[model samples]
Target: MGRVVAIANQKGGVGKTTTAVNLGASLAVAEQRVLLIDLDPQGNASTGVGCAPGSVVRSSYQVLLGEVAVEDAVLETELPHLHVIPSTPDLAAAERELFGDEDWATRFRDAIASIRMQYDFILVDCPPSLGTLTINALTAADLVVVPLQCEYYALEGLSQLTNTIERVRNGLNPGLTIHGVVLTMFDPRNNLANDVAAEVRRHFHVYETVIPRNIRLAEAPSHGKPVILYDAASRGSYQYLNLAREILDALPIQAA
Candidate 1:
């Protein structure tokens, strides 16, 4: 079975969606069959991967609502071995609709279980809050990859997130584990960014590869392409490719 990883953090603009998109694309480029699931209602991951918001006939909304199977909602991306379960704005309503349902938390887990063996990796881009949708993603994931922006306030909400993860591990998915914390938008010139990196490393034993603040990363999505495809020679592309390799290294070896 594929490793199901949720790229999540309750904090917004920490490069969660960007990491999910670029990492998934890089993994695909490395010959891994990858599925990028957009669980965030904002649908940034969908657009980042070049899927137009209204163009998708089926999406995660339908899957969450039980209107369609998760596999049926998956769309093939331009990248070979890369597929996406796009998200639409309608997914926002799923939070309220599933709130009182007894199986609300496990809905995504059940949905993903059906298609777990079809890919090498399943990356879930979660919403920017600790709402029902994020909870669902957490319940469904085997590991969580948190993207932390290198800034002064980056650690402010980490305690809350850790507590939430603890709750999920204890009450929902007992096998859920933290993959590792990734430092995003790092600027070596900025003393604050350096301090943030050091602090995160000290507290969380963050991943060694830190994604620098590169314009290429920001521009890639506008061109409807991943950094690797947009500018393979650029620092951003090389960094994300390395990130993909690091992810594979961190995983348990299994025969392909």
Candidate 2:
């Protein structure tokens, strides 16, 4: 089965979507079949991979609502092996609707079961909150990849996220584990960013690749393309590729 990894961070502006899109693209380029699931209502991951407005009309919203199969919602990306389940604004309403169901937390996990064995990795882009939607994603995931911003305030929410993960592991998913923390938007000149990076490294199992604050990385989303497609030689693209390799190397191979 494909490893389900959620790219998460409760704090916004921490490169969660960026990492999801670029890392998915990088892994696809490496000949890995990747399924990029957009759980964030913003749908940035869908757009980052170039999903058009018309294409996302039937999306994760319908999938969660049981109106469509996971495969029915899957959209092909520019990359050969990368596919995405686009997110719609309607997904924001799923939280309220799912609350009445006793197994709301397992909806995503169950929905993805049929397609789990079809890919090499299933990467979920979670919203920037520890709300019910993120809870569903956490329950569905086997591992989590946290995209942490290299800032002092970003460190503040790490404990809360970890606590939430711990609770999920204890009650909802016993197999859930944190794969690693990835430092993003690093600026070497900023002493505060450097200090925060050091502190995070001291406490967490951080990935070797640190994503730099690149102009190309920032501009790619607006153009509806990943950094690798927009500017493959850019620092952001290269680092994400390195991050993908690190994750691939770290994940254990399972027997068929």
Candidate 3:
């Protein structure tokens, strides 16, 4: 069975989608079959992997709405072992479309079930909100990887997200638990960054790999590539690859 990992944080610009894209690509490069689900309306995960969200005719919107099978919506990426279920701006309306439905929270879980065995890992890039879409992603995921930026306000709203995750675990998916928290956009020159990272570590199971603030990390998405492919020797590429190894080692299941 595949481990369905949701890369989420209600805080925006915290490297959630970046982790999803790069980690997924790095896992593929490590010879693991990976599937990235762009559950965010912005579809940055899709674009980061070279799939244009605007040009996608069939995306996560259709899959979430039950208009199409997930297999039909999955697109192969440039990486041989990586694939993606792209998302569109139309996904912004998913909450309204799913309102009042008794099974709304389980829609995504059901969509991902049939194809669960095909990949070693399925990473979902959730929208930056504790809305219905995020609930669905939480309900579907086996583990949640939170990308937290190392900054003064980094801990803000973390309680609310944890509360939401607790609710999901209690009422929807009992198997859901936080896999680890990744500290992103770190600047060692700033004492505040180190302080924030230490604080996060005291509270959560923090990943050992700290992602540095790098120009290549920010520039890779625009070029429709991961940092590794864009600039293999860059700090961003090295850190994300280290992150992938850390995640793989931490997994309870043996790699497929």
Candidate 4:
């Protein structure tokens, strides 16, 4: 079965969507079948992969509500092996839509069961909050890869996220575990960024590849493409490719 990884960080601007889009693209480039779920209501991951939110007839919103089948909602991306389930703005109100429903937290998990074996990796781009959507993502994922920003304030929220993960493991998803934490937006010239990077590495099971603050990483999404497809020679592209390799090295596949 495929590994479902939730690219999560409750802290916003931490490169969660960036890592999701680029890493998914990189994995696709490596000949792995990948599915990216744009769980964040912003739909930036959809645009990042060249599938604009509104352009799709079915979205993650309908899938979450059990109105659409998971495979039917999957859309092909410009990349060969990468597919995405685009998110619409109305997905932001999914919490209110599923209010008082006992199975709200497991909707995403139940929806993905039929299609989990079709791909090598399934990535979910979680929103920047500890709400129902995020809870659903955590419940569905086998492992979590947190994108932590290189800022002092970012450290303050790490414990809260770990605590949330622990609670989810104890209750919702007993198999859930943190795969690793990735440091993003690193600037070597700044002492603060360097300090934060070292500190994060010392504390967490972090990836050796640190994603620098590259202009191409920011520019690619606006153009509706991943950095690897937009500018393969750019620093962001190369680092994410290396990150994908590193991720693949650590993953040991098992039957679902």
Candidate 5:
């Protein structure tokens, strides 16, 4: 069975999609079969991996609506072992339609379950809200990885996210747990960033790898390429590779 990890955080601009794209690519480069499920309607992850949302025929929306199978919705990326279930703007409406269904929270769980055995890892890129889509991602995931910005208000709403995870674990997915928290867009010159990192480390299982404020990381997405492929020597690329290795090392033996 594949290890399903949800790259989630209710906070936007925290590098959630960036982490999903790069980590999936990094794992694929390491010879692990990776399936990236883009749950966010923005479809940034889909674009980051070279899948144009507007051009995709079958997307997460169709899969969630039961119009297509997960395998049929999967799209090949530029990377050899990396595949993605692209999302479209239509997915934004899934939040409203899903609430009317009895198994709204488990829709994703069931959709992904049948395809779990095909890949070594599956990464879900969640939206920046605690809505039905995010709930679906959390319920489907075995582990959750939160990308936290190194800012003074970084801890704000974190309790709410954790509480939601607890509720999901208790009511929807009993095996759900936090994998680890990764600090993103870090700056060594900022004292506030250092302080926030220390505070997070004291309270949570924070990853040692910190993603620096790199221009290359910001630029790669626009080109529809991961930082590793855009510029492998960049700091952003190195940090994400470190994060991928750390994540692999931290996984359960079965998953590793």
Candidate 6:
């Protein structure tokens, strides 16, 4: 079965989507089959992997609404082993519609269950909020990857996020666990960035690999490509690949 990981954080601009796109692509480059599910209505993950948001016919919206199977909504990305379940603006309505149903939180979990065996990893890119959609993502995921930007006030919202995860583990998904925290947009030159990293490290054992604030990462999305494909030689691309390797190393391998 595939490992479902939700890349989530309530705070925006923390490189959550960036990590989802690049890490998925890098893993694919390493011959790991990856499914990138765009749960965020913004659909940045869809566009980041070269799928046009407007052109996406079937998306996570349909999957969440029970209108289609997740496999039917899957789209091939430019990367060989990377597939995407795109998202559209219509996904915003899912939260309200789902609220009317009793099994709202388990909807996504049920949807993904059928297709869990199709890939090595399934990554859900959640919106920057603790709304119903995010809750659904949390309920469905086996593990959560929280991405924090290296800056002041970055840890301010973490306690709330941790509390939410605890609730999900206790009430919804008992198997849910935090995979790890990633430090993003790190600037080695900035003393504040250094302090923020130290503070975050002090509080949480973060992923050793910190993603630098590289222009290549910001520029790749505009070109409808992940940094791994857009600028493979760039430092950001290398860092993400290394991050993927670290993630893989951290996982316990199943006996053959």
Leading candidate by lDDT = 4
- Give the whole-model CA lDDT for all candidates, comma-separated: 0.89, 0.91, 0.91, 0.92, 0.91, 0.91
lDDT, model 6, position 42: 95
Per-residue lDDT of model 2, residues 72-150, tens digit only: 8888888989999999888999999998898999999999999999999999999999998899999999999999988
Clashing pairs in 2: none
Clash-forming residue pairs, model 4: none
Model 4 has how many clashing residue pairs? 0
Per model, state how many residue pairs clash: 0, 0, 0, 0, 0, 0
* TM-score for predicted model 3 compared with the true structure: 0.97
Clashes of 3: 0
- Clash-forming residue pairs, model 3: none
Candidate 3: Cα lDDT at 83:
96
Off by over 4 Å in 4: 253-256
Candidate 5 structure quality by residue, lDDT tens digits, 153-239: 688867789999999999999999898998888888999998988888887899988888899999999999988899999999888
Model 4 lDDT at residue 188: 84
lDDT of 6 by residue, 178-243 (tens): 888898988789999888888877777689888988999899999999998899999999999999
lDDT of 6 at 232: 95
lDDT of 4 by residue, 74-133 (tens): 999898999999999989999999889999999999999889999999999999998899
Q: Root-mean-square deviation of each candidate, in angstroms?
A: 1.1, 1.0, 1.2, 1.2, 1.2, 1.1
Pull out the clashing pairs in model 6. Answer: none
Candidate 4 lDDT for residue 129: 92
Error of 1 at 63 (Å): 0.5
